[model samples]
Target: MVTSEKNIQMIMELADAFGPSGFEDDVLTVARKWAEGLGTIEEDHMRNLYIHRKENTGNKPVIMLDAHSDEVGFMIHSIKPNGTLRFVTLGRFANIAMSSADVLVRNALGEYIPGVIAAKPVHFMSESERAKGGVPEISSMVIDIGATSAEEAVNRFHIRIGEPGVPATKCRYDAENDVMFGKGFDCRIGCAAVIETLRRLEGMDLPCDVIGVLSSQEEVGERGCKVSVKHANPSIAFVFEGCPADDTFTEPYAIQTALKKGPMLRFMDVSVICSPRYQRYVLDLASEKGIAAQASVREGGGNNGAIINTALDGTPVVVAGVPTRYIHSMNCITSGYDFEETVKLAVATVTSMTPEQIAKF
Candidate 1:
């Protein structure tokens, strides 16, 4: 079983791995290593990871767990005549946040080289350019590794076209406040939660079979999970996420996903509307068990749940979201207590269920 120390380490290692959409080999390495004792691991060309619980029995209903592995990143598009590199975003990025952000470029040799996203300095900008600015166009940005010419970048740095990169932020845990600062919490934190959940359920005998899926390329439109759903073939799915927190920007009365509020159970997101019966069941269960939780009707977000819910003759799905601040940026914030409570609520949901109750959904 994974202990507290091990879980913390796993979360950090996952956050540190540079996995950008199509290049998820490094993140898969971390997940595959930690999922060693769970069961046999399986994958396809898309790198969608899956594991059946060790205690599963063939006759029970299947309960699938999903957490995406890839994080938003950049890909080298071209090399300039000067030493700087031209790039394109691999997934969603707040364009304004790119310039000056610390980055690690995976060179042609597969080694991560430190670099910084660069743009024209203010002093060098024309009066006309200065008048039309609000973070320059994404296409105008470059990654500078202190090279003097394009030839230097290719020969000395081994930088090339098509290589992917991620932010260079490292995971940091604050024990006193239980707040964790890191990169890729959007789904890496969810990935950690799924693995830890599997560990917690190591030998438990329930009326259902459980499996965890760490899908690839989620940031690029849930591409990996569209394939994972066919593989897991679950009767139900619990999609976990490091969901964006609204507390900071939202009005007090409208804050639906707040940090340290256990986890958010979505009623609806752009991707899917949760199964009403299953959603209510989990909400009631959380309240009865005294688990901290929040519910929301999201206007602009989607997840693996949408794909899984509609797959394989219609599977019921729920999302257990860990509220994260500033997702898709170079850094993010989440709370350890929120992760613990999210796991607790899920464990209770799994153990307290039966085939009869599930049929209601």
Candidate 2:
């Protein structure tokens, strides 16, 4: 089973998990469940999850496969007297697309309460507001959960001052098109790839020991990989991401990341330049193995790879990203074909990597 039914289920579950920056318990819950038999799982105080392969010999160099578990979301800042919740952005949400969107707020009781990001309706807007004709500031919006007063909001709804919330979009797959629609594809899809890659390499005897890290709080910054990298101390790393696709808006010749093309192998983004020799090696290997892959030179955007590349004596790292459209917004689209190719490319990479190749890089 190349891209098995379980793999698709895992992708949907990971993408559907309600996880925000600094609030990743739900995401880790799903990750651990799917990764049950793959390795010995351990988590940190900051909720960085590590999966140590059971076949590791402890004598070989460590290889780290990393994907963050957090997504762009909102955090409750204060509740107005009218029972409306004011919020602050967590990570980089597409604020322009946020008004009137459905969200699930995590209340103090650890339950998700449904809400809508409400803004003043057109009838209530002043002439100036209508003439200005621009998107409202996120600060001006409120999350309404049907409570009529602050007392009701707190006492009845259990809403608190610092709860996190994410888009209430569920995952849906189009089997005919091999596409997926959902929220939080920024890194959840990447998380699925890491898990599936580990599963594929389960019984193999490789030149290096591998560890899978479902890191946390990446949308806020590259924070989780800082800890995960130190814990794993890998000599080399493979970072996976659901990168923003440029196909929809970019010029015809400039499109590098497109849905259904393959996983993107980025040489450089805003954060860090990837290991050139290693990137070339993997691209060449993909060609030799006839695996679909895309090469990208991004103008903006970053990932856990930047942190891992500088973590310990500068580990050699490459990022294999699934091309996702409309990331950082409430909803996103990605291709199942891209995901499958990502897993295949990664599996081929680790299986072919050796100590000699590492020395050259």
Best by lDDT: 2
Error of 2 at 20 (Å): 0.4
Tens digit of per-residue lDDT, candidate 1, span 231-340: 88888888899999999999999999999988899999998999999999999999999999899999989999999988777788899999999998998998887888
lDDT of 2 by residue, 98-201 (tens): 98899999998999999999988888888998886645888899999999999999999999998999999999988777888999999999999989999999
Error of 2 at 58 (Å): 0.9
lDDT of each: 0.89, 0.92
Counting clashing residue pairs in each candidate, in order, gives 0, 0
In candidate 1, residue 321 scores what lDDT?
93
